[model samples]
Target: MQNPATTAFVSDFAELPATASHGPLRIEYRWVNEAAGNAPIAVFLHEGLGSVAMWRDWPQALCERLGMRGLVYSRPGYGLSTPREHAVKWPVDFMTAQARDILPALFGVLDIDMQARKRMWVIGHSDGGSIALLYAALHPDALAGAVVIAPHIFVEDLSVESIAQTKALYETTDLRSKLSRYHSDVDSAFYGWNDIWLNAAFREWRIVDELAAIKQALLAVQGHDDNYGTMAQIDTIGERVPHAQLVKLDACGHSPHRDAPDALNEAIAAFISRQRR
Candidate 1:
Protein backbone atom coordinates (compact mmCIF):
# COMPACT_ATOMS: atom_id res chain seq x y z
CA MET A 1 0.00 0.00 0.00
CA GLN A 2 1.20 3.46 -0.82
CA ASN A 3 1.73 6.00 1.89
CA PRO A 4 -1.46 8.09 1.75
CA ALA A 5 0.34 11.13 3.11
CA THR A 6 2.94 11.09 0.40
CA THR A 7 0.90 9.87 -2.55
CA ALA A 8 -1.78 11.74 -4.45
CA PHE A 9 -5.22 10.54 -3.48
CA VAL A 10 -7.17 11.34 -6.65
CA SER A 11 -5.12 12.01 -9.74
CA ASP A 12 -7.89 12.96 -12.17
CA PHE A 13 -11.54 13.47 -11.34
CA ALA A 14 -14.65 14.79 -13.06
CA GLU A 15 -17.51 16.69 -11.48
CA LEU A 16 -21.21 16.49 -12.24
CA PRO A 17 -24.08 18.67 -11.12
CA ALA A 18 -26.50 16.99 -8.75
CA THR A 19 -29.43 18.35 -6.80
CA ALA A 20 -30.20 17.41 -3.20
CA SER A 21 -33.10 18.50 -1.04
CA HIS A 22 -30.61 20.79 0.59
CA GLY A 23 -29.65 22.40 -2.74
CA PRO A 24 -27.53 22.01 -5.88
CA LEU A 25 -24.22 20.18 -5.43
CA ARG A 26 -21.12 18.96 -7.21
CA ILE A 27 -20.21 15.28 -7.21
CA GLU A 28 -16.69 14.05 -7.90
CA TYR A 29 -16.40 10.81 -9.80
CA ARG A 30 -14.07 8.64 -11.86
CA TRP A 31 -14.53 5.98 -14.50
CA VAL A 32 -12.51 2.78 -14.53
CA ASN A 33 -11.86 0.66 -17.62
CA GLU A 34 -13.95 3.04 -19.73
CA ALA A 35 -12.59 1.32 -22.79
CA ALA A 36 -14.79 -1.64 -21.92
CA GLY A 37 -17.57 0.35 -23.52
CA ASN A 38 -20.09 -2.38 -24.16
CA ALA A 39 -19.36 -4.38 -21.02
CA PRO A 40 -21.35 -4.50 -17.82
CA ILE A 41 -21.07 -1.57 -15.43
CA ALA A 42 -19.97 -2.04 -11.83
CA VAL A 43 -20.79 0.76 -9.44
CA PHE A 44 -18.70 0.87 -6.30
CA LEU A 45 -19.78 2.41 -3.01
CA HIS A 46 -17.14 3.02 -0.34
CA GLU A 47 -17.16 2.44 3.39
CA GLY A 48 -18.26 5.04 5.96
CA LEU A 49 -14.80 6.62 6.06
CA GLY A 50 -13.76 5.75 2.51
CA SER A 51 -13.40 7.81 -0.66
CA VAL A 52 -12.59 7.22 -4.30
CA ALA A 53 -8.89 7.37 -3.50
CA MET A 54 -9.25 5.13 -0.50
CA TRP A 55 -10.45 2.39 -2.83
CA ARG A 56 -6.99 2.66 -4.42
CA ASP A 57 -6.47 0.28 -7.37
CA TRP A 58 -8.95 -2.36 -6.31
CA PRO A 59 -11.78 -1.15 -8.53
CA GLN A 60 -9.55 -1.21 -11.55
CA ALA A 61 -8.34 -4.69 -10.74
CA LEU A 62 -11.84 -6.05 -10.24
CA CYS A 63 -13.19 -4.40 -13.36
CA GLU A 64 -10.37 -5.86 -15.39
CA ARG A 65 -10.93 -9.31 -13.97
CA LEU A 66 -14.67 -9.17 -14.57
CA GLY A 67 -14.45 -7.42 -17.96
CA MET A 68 -16.68 -4.68 -16.59
CA ARG A 69 -16.61 -0.93 -16.65
CA GLY A 70 -16.61 0.80 -13.27
CA LEU A 71 -17.98 3.93 -11.71
CA VAL A 72 -16.52 5.20 -8.42
CA TYR A 73 -17.39 8.35 -6.54
CA SER A 74 -17.40 10.15 -3.25
CA ARG A 75 -20.66 10.93 -1.58
CA PRO A 76 -21.39 14.26 0.02
CA GLY A 77 -19.43 14.87 3.24
CA TYR A 78 -16.75 12.51 2.02
CA GLY A 79 -13.85 12.99 -0.41
CA LEU A 80 -13.96 16.01 -2.73
CA SER A 81 -17.63 16.06 -3.72
CA THR A 82 -19.07 18.27 -0.99
CA PRO A 83 -18.69 18.74 2.71
CA ARG A 84 -21.35 18.57 5.37
CA GLU A 85 -22.01 21.58 7.53
CA HIS A 86 -20.25 21.58 10.87
CA ALA A 87 -23.48 22.28 12.73
CA VAL A 88 -25.63 19.80 10.82
CA LYS A 89 -26.18 16.24 11.97
CA TRP A 90 -27.10 13.38 9.65
CA PRO A 91 -30.60 11.99 10.11
CA VAL A 92 -31.01 8.42 11.30
CA ASP A 93 -32.39 7.66 7.82
CA PHE A 94 -29.30 9.09 6.18
CA MET A 95 -28.20 5.87 4.46
CA THR A 96 -31.73 5.41 3.15
CA ALA A 97 -31.72 8.92 1.74
CA GLN A 98 -28.42 8.17 0.02
CA ALA A 99 -29.84 5.12 -1.71
CA ARG A 100 -33.30 6.58 -2.38
CA ASP A 101 -32.24 10.04 -3.48
CA ILE A 102 -28.52 10.47 -4.05
CA LEU A 103 -27.69 7.34 -6.05
CA PRO A 104 -30.58 7.60 -8.53
CA ALA A 105 -29.86 11.27 -8.97
CA LEU A 106 -26.24 10.49 -9.77
CA PHE A 107 -27.29 7.91 -12.32
CA GLY A 108 -29.69 10.39 -13.88
CA VAL A 109 -27.05 13.08 -13.97
CA LEU A 110 -24.65 10.67 -15.63
CA ASP A 111 -27.39 9.73 -18.10
CA ILE A 112 -26.82 6.02 -17.63
CA ASP A 113 -29.00 4.41 -20.29
CA MET A 114 -31.67 1.85 -19.55
CA GLN A 115 -29.56 -0.76 -21.33
CA ALA A 116 -26.70 -0.02 -18.98
CA ARG A 117 -29.02 0.02 -16.01
CA LYS A 118 -30.27 -3.46 -16.86
CA ARG A 119 -26.73 -4.79 -16.65
CA MET A 120 -25.72 -2.65 -13.68
CA TRP A 121 -24.20 -4.18 -10.56
CA VAL A 122 -23.44 -2.54 -7.23
CA ILE A 123 -20.42 -3.45 -5.07
CA GLY A 124 -20.41 -1.77 -1.70
CA HIS A 125 -18.53 -2.08 1.58
CA SER A 126 -19.63 -1.27 5.11
CA ASP A 127 -21.96 1.77 5.13
CA GLY A 128 -21.89 1.73 1.38
CA GLY A 129 -22.97 -1.90 1.49
CA SER A 130 -26.04 -0.99 3.53
CA ILE A 131 -26.89 1.71 1.00
CA ALA A 132 -26.56 -0.75 -1.85
CA LEU A 133 -28.99 -3.12 -0.16
CA LEU A 134 -31.47 -0.31 0.34
CA TYR A 135 -31.18 0.70 -3.29
CA ALA A 136 -31.71 -2.87 -4.44
CA ALA A 137 -34.82 -3.15 -2.24
CA LEU A 138 -36.26 0.17 -3.40
CA HIS A 139 -35.56 -0.46 -7.07
CA PRO A 140 -35.57 -4.19 -7.53
CA ASP A 141 -35.48 -4.02 -11.30
CA ALA A 142 -32.88 -1.30 -11.55
CA LEU A 143 -29.91 -3.57 -11.08
CA ALA A 144 -28.97 -7.08 -12.16
CA GLY A 145 -27.11 -7.94 -8.94
CA ALA A 146 -25.34 -6.62 -5.89
CA VAL A 147 -22.30 -7.53 -3.76
CA VAL A 148 -22.35 -6.32 -0.16
CA ILE A 149 -19.20 -6.71 1.96
CA ALA A 150 -19.36 -6.38 5.71
CA PRO A 151 -22.67 -4.54 5.62
CA HIS A 152 -24.53 -3.41 8.66
CA ILE A 153 -28.17 -4.47 8.46
CA PHE A 154 -28.59 -3.60 12.12
CA VAL A 155 -26.64 -1.66 14.69
CA GLU A 156 -24.45 -3.90 16.81
CA ASP A 157 -22.65 -3.27 20.08
CA LEU A 158 -19.42 -4.38 18.42
CA SER A 159 -19.90 -1.75 15.74
CA VAL A 160 -20.47 1.04 18.24
CA GLU A 161 -17.45 0.02 20.25
CA SER A 162 -15.19 0.00 17.21
CA ILE A 163 -16.47 3.34 16.00
CA ALA A 164 -16.01 4.83 19.48
CA GLN A 165 -12.44 3.56 19.51
CA THR A 166 -11.87 5.09 16.08
CA LYS A 167 -13.13 8.42 17.42
CA ALA A 168 -10.56 8.30 20.15
CA LEU A 169 -7.83 7.37 17.68
CA TYR A 170 -8.78 10.31 15.48
CA GLU A 171 -8.58 12.63 18.43
CA THR A 172 -5.35 11.44 19.93
CA THR A 173 -3.44 9.79 17.14
CA ASP A 174 -2.52 10.58 13.51
CA LEU A 175 -5.61 8.88 12.16
CA ARG A 176 -7.20 12.21 11.27
CA SER A 177 -4.04 13.33 9.55
CA LYS A 178 -3.93 10.19 7.48
CA LEU A 179 -7.62 10.38 6.57
CA SER A 180 -7.37 14.04 5.59
CA ARG A 181 -5.45 13.10 2.48
CA TYR A 182 -8.56 11.40 1.16
CA HIS A 183 -11.11 14.15 1.84
CA SER A 184 -11.43 17.82 1.08
CA ASP A 185 -13.05 18.57 4.41
CA VAL A 186 -11.69 16.05 6.87
CA ASP A 187 -13.90 17.15 9.73
CA SER A 188 -17.01 16.93 7.58
CA ALA A 189 -16.11 13.43 6.49
CA PHE A 190 -15.15 12.20 9.93
CA TYR A 191 -17.73 13.85 12.18
CA GLY A 192 -20.65 13.27 9.86
CA TRP A 193 -20.11 9.52 10.05
CA ASN A 194 -18.77 9.39 13.59
CA ASP A 195 -21.40 11.48 15.33
CA ILE A 196 -24.31 9.65 13.74
CA TRP A 197 -23.10 6.14 14.55
CA LEU A 198 -22.35 7.12 18.13
CA ASN A 199 -25.66 8.89 18.60
CA ALA A 200 -28.05 7.16 21.04
CA ALA A 201 -30.94 7.51 18.60
CA PHE A 202 -29.08 5.51 15.93
CA ARG A 203 -28.83 2.42 18.12
CA GLU A 204 -32.09 1.03 16.77
CA TRP A 205 -31.15 1.64 13.13
CA ARG A 206 -31.61 -1.43 10.95
CA ILE A 207 -32.82 -2.44 7.48
CA VAL A 208 -33.81 -6.04 8.16
CA ASP A 209 -37.36 -5.69 6.80
CA GLU A 210 -36.08 -4.10 3.61
CA LEU A 211 -34.07 -7.20 2.77
CA ALA A 212 -37.20 -9.10 1.82
CA ALA A 213 -38.00 -6.52 -0.83
CA ILE A 214 -34.81 -7.12 -2.77
CA LYS A 215 -35.34 -9.24 -5.86
CA GLN A 216 -32.00 -9.04 -7.59
CA ALA A 217 -29.14 -11.55 -7.34
CA LEU A 218 -27.36 -10.76 -4.09
CA LEU A 219 -23.99 -11.82 -2.63
CA ALA A 220 -23.23 -11.00 1.00
CA VAL A 221 -19.62 -11.34 2.21
CA GLN A 222 -18.24 -11.04 5.72
CA GLY A 223 -15.08 -11.77 7.67
CA HIS A 224 -14.84 -13.92 10.78
CA ASP A 225 -12.50 -11.59 12.60
CA ASP A 226 -14.21 -8.30 11.70
CA ASN A 227 -13.86 -5.97 14.63
CA TYR A 228 -16.63 -3.64 13.52
CA GLY A 229 -19.28 -6.31 12.91
CA THR A 230 -19.84 -10.01 13.37
CA MET A 231 -21.02 -12.91 11.19
CA ALA A 232 -24.59 -12.15 12.24
CA GLN A 233 -24.59 -9.22 9.82
CA ILE A 234 -24.43 -11.37 6.68
CA ASP A 235 -26.17 -14.24 8.43
CA THR A 236 -29.24 -12.07 8.92
CA ILE A 237 -29.03 -11.06 5.30
CA GLY A 238 -29.12 -14.70 4.30
CA GLU A 239 -32.10 -15.27 6.57
CA ARG A 240 -34.05 -12.36 5.09
CA VAL A 241 -33.03 -12.83 1.50
CA PRO A 242 -33.29 -16.55 1.07
CA HIS A 243 -31.74 -16.58 -2.37
CA ALA A 244 -28.79 -14.49 -1.25
CA GLN A 245 -25.37 -16.20 -1.40
CA LEU A 246 -23.25 -15.79 1.68
CA VAL A 247 -19.45 -16.06 1.95
CA LYS A 248 -17.68 -16.30 5.27
CA LEU A 249 -13.97 -15.59 4.97
CA ASP A 250 -11.57 -16.79 7.64
CA ALA A 251 -8.46 -14.73 8.57
CA CYS A 252 -10.17 -11.70 7.14
CA GLY A 253 -11.35 -8.45 8.63
CA HIS A 254 -13.84 -5.63 8.00
CA SER A 255 -12.37 -4.60 4.64
CA PRO A 256 -12.28 -7.69 2.50
CA HIS A 257 -10.97 -5.97 -0.61
CA ARG A 258 -7.95 -4.88 1.38
CA ASP A 259 -7.75 -7.92 3.60
CA ALA A 260 -8.36 -10.62 1.02
CA PRO A 261 -8.51 -9.20 -2.46
CA ASP A 262 -7.95 -12.32 -4.53
CA ALA A 263 -10.45 -14.40 -2.59
CA LEU A 264 -13.00 -11.61 -2.61
CA ASN A 265 -12.58 -11.03 -6.31
CA GLU A 266 -12.88 -14.70 -7.10
CA ALA A 267 -16.06 -15.04 -5.10
CA ILE A 268 -17.61 -11.98 -6.74
CA ALA A 269 -16.59 -13.04 -10.22
CA ALA A 270 -18.03 -16.51 -9.76
CA PHE A 271 -21.28 -15.15 -8.34
CA ILE A 272 -21.68 -12.68 -11.19
CA SER A 273 -20.94 -15.38 -13.77
CA ARG A 274 -23.56 -17.60 -12.21
CA GLN A 275 -26.09 -14.80 -12.37
CA ARG A 276 -25.41 -14.33 -16.08
CA ARG A 277 -25.88 -18.05 -16.74
Candidate 2:
Protein backbone atom coordinates (compact mmCIF):
# COMPACT_ATOMS: atom_id res chain seq x y z
CA MET A 1 0.00 0.00 0.00
CA GLN A 2 1.12 3.53 -0.70
CA ASN A 3 2.24 5.67 2.26
CA PRO A 4 -0.28 8.34 3.19
CA ALA A 5 2.55 10.45 4.54
CA THR A 6 3.88 11.07 1.07
CA THR A 7 1.14 13.63 0.51
CA ALA A 8 -0.81 16.04 2.68
CA PHE A 9 -3.84 14.70 4.45
CA VAL A 10 -6.98 16.69 5.09
CA SER A 11 -7.69 17.59 8.72
CA ASP A 12 -10.64 15.98 10.50
CA PHE A 13 -12.29 17.07 13.72
CA ALA A 14 -13.57 14.97 16.61
CA GLU A 15 -16.16 16.47 18.94
CA LEU A 16 -15.46 15.65 22.58
CA PRO A 17 -18.44 16.16 24.89
CA ALA A 18 -16.47 15.22 27.98
CA THR A 19 -14.71 18.59 27.71
CA ALA A 20 -17.89 20.51 26.95
CA SER A 21 -17.94 22.01 30.42
CA HIS A 22 -14.81 23.98 29.58
CA GLY A 23 -15.92 24.73 26.04
CA PRO A 24 -16.93 22.82 22.97
CA LEU A 25 -13.73 21.20 21.69
CA ARG A 26 -13.23 19.57 18.32
CA ILE A 27 -9.83 17.94 18.08
CA GLU A 28 -8.15 18.44 14.72
CA TYR A 29 -6.19 15.49 13.42
CA ARG A 30 -4.66 14.07 10.28
CA TRP A 31 -3.56 10.55 9.38
CA VAL A 32 -0.15 9.66 7.96
CA ASN A 33 0.71 6.32 6.38
CA GLU A 34 -2.81 5.21 7.25
CA ALA A 35 -2.56 2.30 4.83
CA ALA A 36 0.80 1.04 6.02
CA GLY A 37 -0.89 -2.22 6.79
CA ASN A 38 -0.72 -3.38 10.45
CA ALA A 39 2.39 -1.49 11.42
CA PRO A 40 2.45 0.14 14.84
CA ILE A 41 0.67 3.47 15.07
CA ALA A 42 2.60 6.48 16.29
CA VAL A 43 0.50 9.27 17.78
CA PHE A 44 2.04 12.73 17.62
CA LEU A 45 1.37 15.21 20.43
CA HIS A 46 2.37 18.87 20.10
CA GLU A 47 3.96 21.32 22.52
CA GLY A 48 2.51 24.06 24.77
CA LEU A 49 1.83 26.59 22.03
CA GLY A 50 1.84 24.06 19.22
CA SER A 51 -0.90 23.14 16.79
CA VAL A 52 -1.29 20.67 13.94
CA ALA A 53 -0.15 23.26 11.46
CA MET A 54 2.81 24.19 13.62
CA TRP A 55 4.11 20.64 13.47
CA ARG A 56 4.50 21.15 9.70
CA ASP A 57 5.62 17.88 8.03
CA TRP A 58 7.79 16.38 10.73
CA PRO A 59 5.32 13.73 11.87
CA GLN A 60 4.71 12.57 8.32
CA ALA A 61 8.41 12.52 7.58
CA LEU A 62 9.20 10.47 10.66
CA CYS A 63 6.37 8.01 10.02
CA GLU A 64 7.43 7.60 6.38
CA ARG A 65 11.00 6.87 7.41
CA LEU A 66 9.87 4.25 9.94
CA GLY A 67 7.14 2.72 7.75
CA MET A 68 4.59 3.36 10.48
CA ARG A 69 1.06 4.71 10.62
CA GLY A 70 0.65 8.06 12.35
CA LEU A 71 -2.00 10.17 14.06
CA VAL A 72 -1.23 13.81 14.68
CA TYR A 73 -3.69 15.91 16.65
CA SER A 74 -4.07 19.28 18.28
CA ARG A 75 -5.22 19.34 21.87
CA PRO A 76 -8.06 21.59 23.03
CA GLY A 77 -7.34 25.31 22.62
CA TYR A 78 -4.66 24.59 20.08
CA GLY A 79 -4.44 24.67 16.31
CA LEU A 80 -7.87 24.30 14.81
CA SER A 81 -9.24 22.58 17.92
CA THR A 82 -11.62 24.15 20.43
CA PRO A 83 -10.75 27.45 21.99
CA ARG A 84 -10.73 27.80 25.76
CA GLU A 85 -13.36 29.85 27.61
CA HIS A 86 -11.74 33.22 28.15
CA ALA A 87 -12.71 33.24 31.82
CA VAL A 88 -11.39 29.80 32.59
CA LYS A 89 -7.89 29.37 33.91
CA TRP A 90 -6.26 25.98 33.50
CA PRO A 91 -5.82 24.13 36.79
CA VAL A 92 -2.52 22.81 38.05
CA ASP A 93 -3.52 19.30 37.03
CA PHE A 94 -4.26 20.34 33.46
CA MET A 95 -1.87 17.79 31.99
CA THR A 96 -3.48 15.13 34.13
CA ALA A 97 -6.90 16.10 32.81
CA GLN A 98 -5.58 15.87 29.25
CA ALA A 99 -4.11 12.41 29.77
CA ARG A 100 -7.03 11.00 31.74
CA ASP A 101 -9.96 12.73 30.09
CA ILE A 102 -9.34 14.58 26.82
CA LEU A 103 -7.16 12.02 25.09
CA PRO A 104 -9.37 9.02 25.87
CA ALA A 105 -12.43 10.87 24.67
CA LEU A 106 -10.60 11.77 21.48
CA PHE A 107 -9.54 8.17 20.91
CA GLY A 108 -13.06 6.92 21.52
CA VAL A 109 -14.43 9.47 19.09
CA LEU A 110 -11.84 8.39 16.54
CA ASP A 111 -12.42 4.69 17.31
CA ILE A 112 -8.79 3.84 17.91
CA ASP A 113 -8.79 0.48 19.66
CA MET A 114 -5.74 0.53 21.83
CA GLN A 115 -6.57 -2.93 23.08
CA ALA A 116 -6.51 -4.36 19.57
CA ARG A 117 -3.65 -2.19 18.37
CA LYS A 118 -1.33 -3.17 21.16
CA ARG A 119 1.74 -1.76 19.42
CA MET A 120 0.39 1.81 19.53
CA TRP A 121 3.02 4.36 20.57
CA VAL A 122 2.91 8.01 21.57
CA ILE A 123 5.51 10.50 20.33
CA GLY A 124 5.16 13.78 22.19
CA HIS A 125 7.00 17.08 22.44
CA SER A 126 7.24 19.50 25.39
CA ASP A 127 3.84 19.77 27.07
CA GLY A 128 2.68 16.95 24.84
CA GLY A 129 5.65 14.93 26.07
CA SER A 130 4.49 15.32 29.65
CA ILE A 131 0.98 14.37 28.59
CA ALA A 132 2.28 11.26 26.81
CA LEU A 133 4.20 10.23 29.93
CA LEU A 134 1.10 10.75 32.03
CA TYR A 135 -0.99 8.71 29.60
CA ALA A 136 1.51 5.85 29.60
CA ALA A 137 1.55 5.91 33.38
CA LEU A 138 -2.22 5.90 33.68
CA HIS A 139 -2.77 3.31 30.95
CA PRO A 140 0.28 1.10 31.19
CA ASP A 141 -1.45 -1.76 29.41
CA ALA A 142 -2.66 0.38 26.52
CA LEU A 143 0.59 1.58 24.99
CA ALA A 144 3.57 -0.24 23.48
CA GLY A 145 6.02 2.53 24.28
CA ALA A 146 6.55 6.29 24.28
CA VAL A 147 9.09 8.84 23.03
CA VAL A 148 9.12 12.09 25.02
CA ILE A 149 10.99 15.08 23.61
CA ALA A 150 11.85 17.90 25.99
CA PRO A 151 9.31 16.68 28.54
CA HIS A 152 8.85 18.36 31.87
CA ILE A 153 8.49 16.00 34.82
CA PHE A 154 8.72 18.83 37.30
CA VAL A 155 8.59 22.62 37.47
CA GLU A 156 11.99 24.26 37.26
CA ASP A 157 13.39 27.74 37.86
CA LEU A 158 14.73 27.88 34.30
CA SER A 159 11.34 26.97 32.92
CA VAL A 160 9.66 29.67 34.91
CA GLU A 161 12.26 32.22 33.85
CA SER A 162 11.94 31.34 30.16
CA ILE A 163 8.15 31.34 30.33
CA ALA A 164 8.25 34.77 31.93
CA GLN A 165 10.44 35.96 29.13
CA THR A 166 8.00 34.60 26.60
CA LYS A 167 5.24 36.54 28.27
CA ALA A 168 7.28 39.68 27.81
CA LEU A 169 7.97 38.89 24.17
CA TYR A 170 4.30 38.17 23.58
CA GLU A 171 3.52 41.66 24.81
CA THR A 172 6.31 43.67 23.19
CA THR A 173 7.07 41.76 20.02
CA ASP A 174 5.13 40.22 17.12
CA LEU A 175 5.15 36.80 18.77
CA ARG A 176 1.41 36.90 19.34
CA SER A 177 0.81 37.84 15.73
CA LYS A 178 3.05 35.02 14.55
CA LEU A 179 1.26 32.53 16.79
CA SER A 180 -2.15 33.79 15.69
CA ARG A 181 -1.58 32.13 12.37
CA TYR A 182 -1.46 28.77 14.16
CA HIS A 183 -4.18 29.16 16.84
CA SER A 184 -7.70 30.50 16.55
CA ASP A 185 -7.58 32.20 19.92
CA VAL A 186 -4.05 33.32 20.62
CA ASP A 187 -4.71 34.67 24.10
CA SER A 188 -6.53 31.55 25.20
CA ALA A 189 -3.75 29.32 23.96
CA PHE A 190 -0.94 31.46 25.27
CA TYR A 191 -2.28 32.41 28.71
CA GLY A 192 -3.77 29.01 29.36
CA TRP A 193 -0.26 27.61 29.24
CA ASN A 194 1.63 30.68 30.43
CA ASP A 195 -0.41 31.62 33.50
CA ILE A 196 -0.23 28.20 35.10
CA TRP A 197 3.47 27.77 34.53
CA LEU A 198 4.25 31.22 35.91
CA ASN A 199 1.98 30.78 38.89
CA ALA A 200 3.96 30.48 42.13
CA ALA A 201 1.75 27.62 43.26
CA PHE A 202 2.83 25.58 40.24
CA ARG A 203 6.41 25.38 41.44
CA GLU A 204 5.41 22.29 43.39
CA TRP A 205 4.12 20.58 40.28
CA ARG A 206 5.90 17.30 39.66
CA ILE A 207 5.06 14.01 37.90
CA VAL A 208 8.10 11.99 38.99
CA ASP A 209 5.98 9.77 41.23
CA GLU A 210 3.72 8.99 38.30
CA LEU A 211 6.64 7.77 36.19
CA ALA A 212 7.21 4.71 38.35
CA ALA A 213 3.94 3.17 37.21
CA ILE A 214 4.76 3.21 33.50
CA LYS A 215 5.67 -0.38 32.55
CA GLN A 216 6.03 0.23 28.79
CA ALA A 217 9.33 1.10 27.18
CA LEU A 218 10.23 4.81 27.21
CA LEU A 219 12.77 7.04 25.48
CA ALA A 220 13.34 10.47 26.98
CA VAL A 221 15.07 13.08 24.79
CA GLN A 222 16.14 16.66 25.30
CA GLY A 223 18.47 19.23 23.80
CA HIS A 224 21.65 20.06 25.68
CA ASP A 225 20.96 23.76 25.09
CA ASP A 226 17.23 23.67 25.82
CA ASN A 227 16.42 27.01 27.37
CA TYR A 228 13.03 25.99 28.75
CA GLY A 229 14.41 23.12 30.84
CA THR A 230 17.61 21.47 31.92
CA MET A 231 18.76 17.86 31.60
CA ALA A 232 17.28 17.12 35.02
CA GLN A 233 13.90 16.61 33.37
CA ILE A 234 15.04 13.55 31.38
CA ASP A 235 17.45 12.60 34.14
CA THR A 236 14.57 12.30 36.58
CA ILE A 237 12.75 10.04 34.14
CA GLY A 238 15.79 7.76 33.91
CA GLU A 239 16.12 7.72 37.68
CA ARG A 240 12.47 6.77 38.21
CA VAL A 241 11.84 4.64 35.16
CA PRO A 242 14.94 2.45 35.35
CA HIS A 243 14.39 1.05 31.86
CA ALA A 244 13.97 4.43 30.21
CA GLN A 245 16.66 5.53 27.72
CA LEU A 246 17.94 9.10 27.63
CA VAL A 247 19.33 11.08 24.67
CA LYS A 248 20.80 14.54 24.96
CA LEU A 249 21.47 16.27 21.67
CA ASP A 250 24.23 18.83 21.39
CA ALA A 251 23.70 22.48 20.26
CA CYS A 252 19.99 21.90 20.01
CA GLY A 253 17.30 23.90 21.77
CA HIS A 254 13.83 23.24 23.16
CA SER A 255 12.35 22.07 19.87
CA PRO A 256 14.50 19.17 18.74
CA HIS A 257 12.21 18.25 15.88
CA ARG A 258 12.71 21.70 14.42
CA ASP A 259 16.38 22.08 15.32
CA ALA A 260 17.57 18.52 14.73
CA PRO A 261 14.87 16.67 12.84
CA ASP A 262 17.16 14.02 11.32
CA ALA A 263 18.70 13.05 14.64
CA LEU A 264 15.35 13.11 16.49
CA ASN A 265 13.68 10.96 13.85
CA GLU A 266 16.50 8.41 13.90
CA ALA A 267 16.40 8.19 17.66
CA ILE A 268 12.63 7.70 17.72
CA ALA A 269 12.67 5.15 14.87
CA ALA A 270 15.36 3.11 16.60
CA PHE A 271 13.65 3.34 19.98
CA ILE A 272 10.30 2.22 18.61
CA SER A 273 11.91 -0.62 16.68
CA ARG A 274 13.77 -1.86 19.73
CA GLN A 275 10.70 -1.65 21.93
CA ARG A 276 8.51 -3.48 19.41
CA ARG A 277 10.94 -6.38 19.30
Best by lDDT: 1
Query: For candidate 1, what's the RMSD?
Result: 2.7
What TM-score does each of the candidates earn?
Answer: 0.95, 0.94
For candidate 1, lDDT tens digit of each residue in 132-225? 9999999888899999999999999999999999999999999999898888889999999999999999999999999999999999999998
Model 2 lowest lDDT segment of ten? 1-10
On the 0 to 100 scale, the lDDT of residue 245 in model 1 is 98
Q: What overall lDDT goes with each candidate model?
A: 0.90, 0.87
Q: Give one clash count per candidate, in the order shown.
A: 0, 0
Task: Kindly report which residue pairs in candidate 1 clash with one another.
Answer: none
Error of 1 at 74 (Å): 0.2
lDDT of 1: 0.90
TM value for model 2: 0.94
- Please list all clashing residue pairs in model 2, or write none if there are none: none
